[model samples]
Target: MLERIGITNFKAFACQDVDLAAFTLLTGLNSSGKSTVLQSLALLRQSHEAGLLDEADESGGFLLNGELVRLGTGQDVRHESYTEEDPDITLAVVKDEIRYAWRARYGREDDLLGLLEAPSGPTSWATRDLPSLFGHGFQYLKADRIVPDVSYPRSHDAAVRRSFLGARGEHTVNFLRAHQDDTITAKSLQLPEMPSTSLREATDYWMQRLCPGVNIETVGIHGTDTVRLSYGFGSGVSASNRYRPTNVGFGLTYALPIVVACVAAQPGSLILLENPEAHLHPQGQTWLAYLAVAAVSAGAQIVLETHSDHVLNGLRLAVKDGRIPASATAVHFFRRNGQTAEVISPSMGPDGMLSDWPKGFFDEWENSLEQLLD
Candidate 1:
């Protein structure tokens, strides 16, 4: 697992070291650098996947655009008020006790920021010895995911071989179609209310948390390169009736990949999510946090960026209930300071009480209540 992340001259951060745990929640104000943390990891994963961080190679470096992330040119990523005259964007991850840092030169127009120095380590970053960010079970889901569509593309290589659901979860339908019958090995991720522990049934169980009695169907389109996803609503005593994705509301389709991603997580897996609360109702946000907690209990590490107070409370409840330890979780509140973003981390106690609640940290509910009572 990543113990901490060191980022300098990257986007909203000038030089900051963010501590991480099994499950880290990044919260706070809009555009205050919550997303920047996730982007830094995604950047390295995308860069490594492109073979830019190969051991002997020094010319190739961080790829600005790729499957995992599209960060645009160097100027777009470099901090607005970089401290140094020669801007060097650095990203480091501390796994175990070793710190692996990668420095790249800032190019005005170059998409590939050539390496300024090799990744700081005995061996290259991509070697099997180290805890790699680009592992088989890694997933990074952006906030803007696939919407309600008639069909989605089916990529066998992506869904089956690579086991990737795509950054926007574009391949989720195909992935579900392939792994529906696979048994979920994690007990924490299983749904006791459901009849079976298969991926499909378990997934339906979680989606029901978002919308009761909601079900999903994924199948290949005949003679086409795509797959179809439909929703079924369980009514009074009969079998659920099928409906197209368009007919169903957007929330179910939007939250499917999240359920799949959490359930499929195995030990040593790394999942990064941005705004899992997007399009979700209050209750759904809480349930989503439960699913994330379950993933952590199953041995996967999650770094989530969210703005929902409900999501924060759910995680707190998880810690209180002993589903996860308070030490295993970290909550970071980010606030803007001029050109950079500053983070304040509040520790969770076993009773679900936070050690400190910064001024703007999930206090909107109380703030509004105070106004109404006055």
Candidate 2:
């Protein structure tokens, strides 16, 4: 698992280091640099996947626009307050007691920043020695996910060959259709209430938490390169006719990728989620947090970016109930301080109490209640 990430002269941060855990929660207001952290990691994965991180090749460097992220040129990613003395952009990550660092020379209009050869940098290490970010079992789901649609793209390379649900989760329907019956090896992620350990069963079990008695089915639209997702209510003879995705609520469709991601997580996997709580009700948001916690228990690392108090409280409840230990979780509250972004990490205790709650850290409810009481 990734223990820490260090950034220098990157977007929204002049220099900053953020500690990571098995399950990390990043909460902050709009544009306070929350997404920047995820983007930095995604950028690294994108670069390496495109054969740009080959330190031996001087032509290789960071790939700004790619499958995972679409960051602009160096001029767009470089911090505004970078010092002329050290203008190069650097990113480093520590995993399993090894530190991998990279420094890229800045170019105003260039999207592929060139790598600098340094004795201590990753340029000398082999591809196998690099961090696990470049390997399989990595999923990055952006905030803007799929909505209710008649059919979604069905790509054999993306859904079956790579087992990748697109960043926007556009390929989720096809992926589900291909692997619905595969057994979920992670015991912790399998709900006891469900009779089967298949991915389809587990997905339905979790989705039911958001909408009770809902069953899902995915099928390839004959003669077309697309997959259709339909939902039905009830069971056996009482079951309602299968309804197209367009007939269901938006929240159910929007939450499908997240549900599938957590259900299919394996040991040593890295899942980066952005606003899994979007379109979910308070209770459903809490249940989603529980699902993520279960994924962590199965040995996968989850880095969640959310703006829901229900999600936060669900994590606390999980810890309090012994579902997950306090030491395995980390919460960072972020906010802007002038031109740069700042982070405040609150420690979690065994009893699920937080060591500190910053001024704007999920206090809106209390602040409003006090005003109403007065």
Candidate 3:
């Protein structure tokens, strides 16, 4: 697992070091630079996979994005006016017993040269070795788009197993069906309470967890040359089942990726999700948090970016209920000033309690209540 991540001259972060746990929660207001942290890690992993740097690149010396490598510089690094004269990108990671760094500088020739320096400590795993580990080992879910349609063409040559769900989750069903025989899927399906009604059974169970009393069913129909998955929700006592994605509430479709991703992830994978609680009801948001905890227990590391206090509370409850160890989770809040962002980390104790709650944290609700009273 990644123990620590240090970044400089990357997007909104001038310099920041984040200590990571098995499950990490990032919370903050809009544009506070929380997303930058995740983006930096993604870029680092990409660079490593591409072999752009050497062992020496792991140190603090490399220039990043034309600005001197510093923590908390607010200038936009992606601007065209940015010059390589100031080194901009530098990052490091502590994995196992080794400390590795990657640094880069824009050359006079306008080419970027990055070095992946060797580990400074025990030679367990080299920094260059992380790409493959990070490449398939991590999956990121962005919030802007919901899953797209993945109807299979009637052609006889359609690929049997599609690549893992795309960033927008277009291939959600194909991905899940591809992993039906995996150990994780086998175990989850074996649960006695899990309805074995059909392929839709598991999906329905997941949907119900998000919205109580709601039932969902997915049906696959092959017409002449195409295959498609249709959703049906609510039966008898509840709201009528709907057929189209647009017909269901936004919360249901928006939360679908999170549910599908968690259930489909393999052991030892790191899942980075942005706003898994988006469009969710308070109860649904809490249930999503519970799902995240369950994912961690199944051996996947989850890093979530959220704006919901309910989600935070649910994580605390997960700890209290012994679903996850307090030490396994870390919560970081990002506060922005001018161009730079500051990070504050709150620890979760063994008793499932937060060690500190910063002032103004979750203040939106208070502000709204005050306005009403006034």
Candidate 4:
């Protein structure tokens, strides 16, 4: 697994190292550099998948535009006040204590940033396996995901071969349609209430947390290369009429990929989520946290970037409730200083309380309540 990530001359950060665990929560104010961290991992995965992360050739390097992330050219990714006279951007990851760093020379208008330096050695499973980033399973869900669409694109390579749900979750319906019957053997991820432990059944069991009695169905269009998704509610005596996604609420569709991603997670999967609490209510947001915890407990590594205090609280509750140990989880609160970004990670105790609460770290609620009561 990727134990830590080190960034230099990246967007909003000159230099930073973040520790990753079974479940890592990246939380902070808007634009404080939470998304940047996820983008870094996505950027590496995108480049590696294309076989561009090669040390043999200096021409090989970070591919800014790809399936996982489109990070633009050097001007867009380099830190505004980048250090060193060379102005090369560097990103490194520590996997099982081995550090792999890739330095890319800056190019003004080039999306493919050439490598200045790459890891050199006899190749083995350490670099070959790359447990968290490759092989096992990977999913990157951007904040702006698919909405209530009539039909979604069906890509066999993306959904079936690669098992990717797309950055915006555009291929989610097809992925679900293909893998619906797959059984989930993870004890932690299984929903006891559901009769079967199949992916489709597990998806419904978890999706209900966001919206009660909600069920989903994805069907392929007869002649077209598209699939349609519909929702139904079992709320009342009147059995829910099967309705198009447009008829149901937006939150259900918006949160579907996240739920599906977690439900379909394998033991060594790496799931990077951006605000899984997009459109859910307070209770639903907390439930989403529990779902993330369940994914981690199932043996996957999840790096979540969220702004919801409820998500934070839910993680703390998970630790306190003995669902996940404090050590298995890591929380980093980020903040900006002028043009550079900095992170302050308050450790989680066994009791689920943080070792320290940095200013503006999920304390807005208490701050606002005090003023209102005063």
Tens-place lDDT per residue, model 3, 303-343, is: 88999999999999989988889989999989876667788
Model 2 lDDT-worst window of ten: 118-127
Per-residue lDDT of 52-73 in model 1, one digit per residue for the tens? 7754355678898999888889
Worst lDDT window (10 residues) for model 1?
A: 123-132
For residue 137, give model 1's deviation from the true position in Å: 0.4
Per-residue lDDT for 156-209 in model 2, tens only?
998888788989999999999999999988878888899999999999999999
What clash count does candidate 1 reach? 0
RMSD of each: 1.6, 1.7, 6.2, 1.6
Error of 1 at 70 (Å): 1.1
Q: Estimated TM-score per prediction?
A: 0.97, 0.96, 0.77, 0.97
Off by over 4 Å in 4: 56-58, 122-127, 235-238
Candidate 4 C-alpha lDDT tens digits along 101-154: 899988989899998787886544333748678564899999999999889998
lDDT of 3 at 287: 84
